[model samples]
Target: MSADKPKPAGVKIVDAAKKELMNVSAIERDGNFLVVKGKIFGTMPMTAKLSPEEARKALRMLSPGLVWFLLTFPFRRSPEPPAR
Candidate 1:
């Protein structure tokens, strides 16, 4: 995609950096770029563009975070045990 083209929201690009890199938590839209948690257990920034559908597809492919997030976000938190 062209540099001028805007990136779709919520897409996670499993590009070379991701493959090379571990322990990443989030992939978010930043301007025209996508910011992913680095494999080094940190954060890595990628400058790429994708369509919304493409973004969603990429997100699903790369990160288990998304799947689990969607799966668990809707449910309420479990209650803690009573104090002794």
Candidate 2:
């Protein structure tokens, strides 16, 4: 396989990150770069591109915030329960 192609797990890891991270819910890979895209407030478009090392660093930095968001975002109630 060409080195440019990511291993299957790379896609999975990126997918999970996109799902769990705020403002970063879509992602793709371009060679060694990870391409991330999502919306702020679920409406404003945002994007980022990261090399492999940068991607790893970003994930590490985001891990705590992701955990905290997951822990707190769902149970806390809004005036109305969220639609989804």
Candidate 3:
């Protein structure tokens, strides 16, 4: 019970998840957990409970630009040398 002690996680991940998810409902918060209830690949109802750290990691992984960058990185040619 100290000011320096961190408070238990709340809904911080909801926003991040929504931004990353973009197409589904992912804004439910339960205690220190984020509950994302929705369909996946139009297959079935996928309900995932994620902690704050997990959510942040997922956000990074789910980034469209990041995914494309990683996919195309190997094929991208390096820049040419500057003119003398």
Clashes of 3: 0
The sequence of per-residue lDDT tens digits that candidate 2 reaches over residues 1-84 is 657855343212223334422455567887888788776554566777888887677667767778799789778863654487
In candidate 1, stretches whose alpha carbon ends up further than 4 angstroms from where it belongs are 1-21, 40-53, 58-69, 73-84
Candidate 3 yields a Cα-based lDDT of 0.64
Candidate numbers sorted by lDDT from highest down: 3, 2, 1
Higher-scoring candidate on lDDT, 2 or 3: 3
Q: CA shift at 39, candidate 3, in angstroms?
A: 0.3
What residue pairs clash in candidate 2, if any at all?
A: none
Clashes of each: 3, 0, 0
CA RMSD of all predictions: 12.1, 10.7, 13.9
- Candidate 2: stretches off by over 4 Å: 1-25, 56-84
Candidate 3 regions off by >4 Å? 1-23, 56-84
Best by TM-score: 2
Q: List the residue pairs that clash in candidate 3.
A: none
TM-scores for all predictions: 0.25, 0.37, 0.35
Better of 2 and 3 by TM-score: 2
Residues 21-73, model 3: lDDT tens digits: 22354558899997876655444556788899987888776678898898998
- Report the lDDT tens digits of candidate 1 across residue range 1-84: 657856444423344444433444456686665656433423644333455677777776856787788788659574575799
